[model samples]
Target: MHGLLSAYSPLSKVIRKKGIPYLCSPMPPSTRTPYTGSSRKLVLAFDVGTTYSGISYSILDPGQVPEIKGVTRFPAQEKVGGSSKIPTVIYYDKAGKVRAVGAEALRESLRDTIEDEGWVKAEWFKLHMRPKAITSSNPMDKIPPLPAGKSVVDLFGDFIRYLYSCAKLYITESHANGTQLWSSVERTIDFVLTHPNGWEGGQQQQMRKAAIQAGLVPDTIEGHARIRFVTEGEASLHFCIQSGLTTEALKSGGGVMIVDAGGGTIDLSAYGEGPTKGTFEEIASPQCHLQGSVYVTIRARTFLENYLRESKFVEDVEAMTEYFDKSAKLTFDSNPLFIKFGGARDRDPKLRIRGGQLTLSGTEVAAFFEPSVSCIIRAIKMQCMAAKKPISSLFLVGGFSASEYLFSKLKEELAPLGPNVCRPDSHLNKAVADGAVSFYLDHVVAMRVSRFLYGTKCKVNYDRKRADHVLRFAGVFNDVDGIPCLAGSFDVILPKDVQVSETQEFRKHYIQKAFDRIGLEAATSLIYCYRGALEKPLWWNGSSDFSALCTIKADTSKISRCLKPRLTTWGQTYYEMFFDIVLSFGLTELTAQIAWLEDGVEKRSPAKIVYDVDA
Candidate 1:
């Protein structure tokens, strides 16, 4: 009879019938509609940068492509006698009004004409907000400062707001196809803000909050006016991908390294395909350090400062801040002082420096930046090694990516690695913003094609002695043929990564028992172990013993039933199950089944039988 009972047990019964479970979640809302012919308008894509920004507009006509207008440093209006490249400065007047920002602010400093009473300074201001301080091997110390009292956060907000204002003005003043067209329909402007991917979560959050505060969106914008964020390297990749470059060939899974040498930070990331077919992935997470164009610029400025001092050309560096600021704009010119002092070479031949009887060519200017460029290349090479993949190609982007000398140096350094090293077209700086927009569109569209699953169930089992020892309690069970059985073993359902969008379903499964009325006190627990090692438990420390079955709760009900799981998204793969458990009561023993899915089908099997008794 015992043999027969064992043969007919619930566990045996389940073993005889193997099956799996199928789960589903609610579908995402639709975002597409019939394309009725409407007046062709433009969608603005703005890339807001530390020292410069660019805007590109795409016409919505059925076959029209996006067009990039002028990319310039802020303060669109030319200074009375100043060079370009927004100075990254802001100042206030005696009347407490913002007197200047960008290039004008830099001019005031260079000329030593800035008023003391209402002035504020901000040089390399963006670098200050990052987790690490910007440093260089050169002797360029003492960055320009913002107002003494205003926080860096506030200054950033103000600067972004100023950019939006400038953008609005530019759109209004510019001609549409050279016809000086204007429109009554307020054009929807979408912003893409780029940041170093290595930023801490808190810093990313702060940037988002600041963007919202700066009116990037209208609490809610009409139509698709939105502000999105993308990492700088990823953005540059997008720019390269769109530039009719070799991106398509590279996408077949070959490893590629991206180096984003920007104004305030150098960001690096790797992408590659696995040995198997179609298993492309971002090989290494992005890394960032506070070193970029500003480092070289500062070094060049220092060299010039010392050169001027020794030559008796300038008495005080501080007194000549405005002049230096203007001279910095000479970046577009050949033989600018920055180049003469060891900056990157200029491509423009017309920009020659006039000395008493000496003329400096681009080569002389390029010599100044050779050392700095070498430093940058070395950093890139180090980062490539850290990625651990044999790089098949190297892509450079950002403001400094355009430096011909820097590009040449990169080729030389990476030559042994292979010949695929290249720079994205001039528009690489806008890549991040463009990528953000593309990502958004892809995500929204993909949701329409795939359904997500949320909450599900799984079962747990343990030896009777082990269970009793772990729980410090006893329980009994009945044999399959109805004979009384000793308290020897136990089984329970443990929640894994169940993709419940909300907490309600999580609670219901844990609390809803067929025969038990365990109070909430019996449900709290310390550790909720899944299938593997219990190194990182979900609960807080000292809450309850591991033996005490804790109730697992999802934060929202929507996730429990409405969220469709996607294979590509991390949120779906991380969670396995979605229920909680508690101590049982009322019987000498209990035997039952816990339902869980195996493949696509649901199955129930004898999980465990717990004996009710005092340990």
Candidate 2:
């Protein structure tokens, strides 16, 4: 029955678009344009976080003061106005309708009644969507259930839709007076959805589909609207760049690490520059998903639950559950337990549990999640090593990054590295989303690439217990002149960390000698393998191999043929590069050329080519 329903689902039909469109509309005549050279326009940036989401618009006009809203700013800046932090929560009412979202939703979740009348609060929801978590058989079964027959996906989609509607309403209210930022109704309301770097292709596609279904796009309204996906870490980097961190880092070409520790996940990325001309490069991509505040909170909750269980004050398990829920509702200021855990008082306090009262210390609460905290530190160290660069400075962002305990722990762990570690001036929660907005505006054509390569094949050692595969390099080739290049004979273009794009050409110089007069016979035997590094070959292990054997007619007129076929890596790079190239040629996705030929001859052949390394 489940299989039957899954077969009929819309997941299959929702195609992934290769590129995002850039929309620019004319400004209205009423408002005074900021620049005399170019028309002023506003771009809306939305940070759709796991625990909180916020939207802000930026205008190119110099006179405009962009209003900061939601949570408070760090360092208490005079110019920074409004709340900068929004709780990442969505609450459903008794009628299965979205009663509140963000901060309000968080407040509502504190009430016990919110949980009774089908009022659901999604906490650490994004974490549950991780690949490992989602692939689990009963991932959602452990979580609290919602309305009749509603899946986690459905509930999440509904909540997101509500958030989108609220964001739209906020935009509408702000622009009600026909302000300069929203003067041009045509393109004034573009939104950018920020996501984690680790989101898989399927997850991203699902989010896009959900956004469309939620009527978040302009198409859902009477006119056109634009919605874009921006990586959260990248967005925060943009914010840093805009705030002059990029300039400072560039001047010295010094290495810096940016850590975005949020409710759902912790993201870390490192940047540095090449030796000559200070050619900037992102040394390490965002890693460290386990370093989230949710884990810490869960650890605290577990300790409290265990304490309650041992105390025996509450006889029934159901009653204990209620107590746990109530205990979770206590804020740092209101909850005596939180105050004790936060080290506000000197001695440990006893809390009434299932049978009796148990005394616990702040140190004990902090020690409960030491393993999780260690995982974060290990991740940071791994990223630093992968970077192969010296770290000169470290910057922390996100809600969890602001935690005194987390900050102190990171400092203590990283103290030996002797780098300047500090937090950003802006609120950590809003940093990524805000940065992403600024990045989208400043670097409209920015593209990120991940490459895979094909190389020589050899026997690999397999460990059954550990499930590990170790690669062994067989041999190296000196030349390709007489090399009867068979199916498996290939090399990876860019290794694991090497970044290549569609617009950027990757070519391997191949020289082929006509062996016999066969009309495109052996030419079709040529197979191209796209891989990251040249050390390991990227051959398909099963039926759908990309290796192709090309057969070409041996004619004296076309004796010397050199082929430079453009290869595309799968995933984000392929989509981005393809879009850019197509747009550059003034061609749409439908109109793009699909076939490639060497000279005038058509290289028709089966894509799958099998080859024996010994042969």
Q: What is the lDDT of candidate 1?
A: 0.44
What's each prediction's clash count? 50, 51
Q: What TM-score would you give candidate 2 relative to the actual structure? A: 0.62
Instruction: Please give the RMSD to the true structure for each candidate, in Å.
Output: 18.8, 14.9
lDDT of each: 0.44, 0.46
- Cα lDDT tens digits, model 1, 1-615, are 000000000110011111211111121222223223355544444454556655544333433333334334345346453222344556765544566776556553444557546455555666556643223344553456666666666666777777666556666655564223325323444555667754433344455556667766555434223555556665555444334332343554456677887766777766554333322334554567655666556655565566565443344344333343334422433443432322233222333323221133456556546655666677667656655456677777777666555666676677886636666433545555554443332211100100011112322232345543345233334322232333322222323322112111222243221111221112222222233334334322232222222223322232233223323232222212333332211111111233433454654432332211110
The TM-score values for the models, in the order shown, are 0.55, 0.62
Q: State the number of backbone clashes in model 1.
A: 50
Candidate 2, after superposition: displacement of residue 528 in Å? 15
Candidate 1 deviant stretches above 4 angstroms: 1-45, 59-76, 79-87, 94-96, 103-113, 116-118, 132-142, 175-189, 218-225, 248-253, 273-280, 301-375, 386-389, 424-615
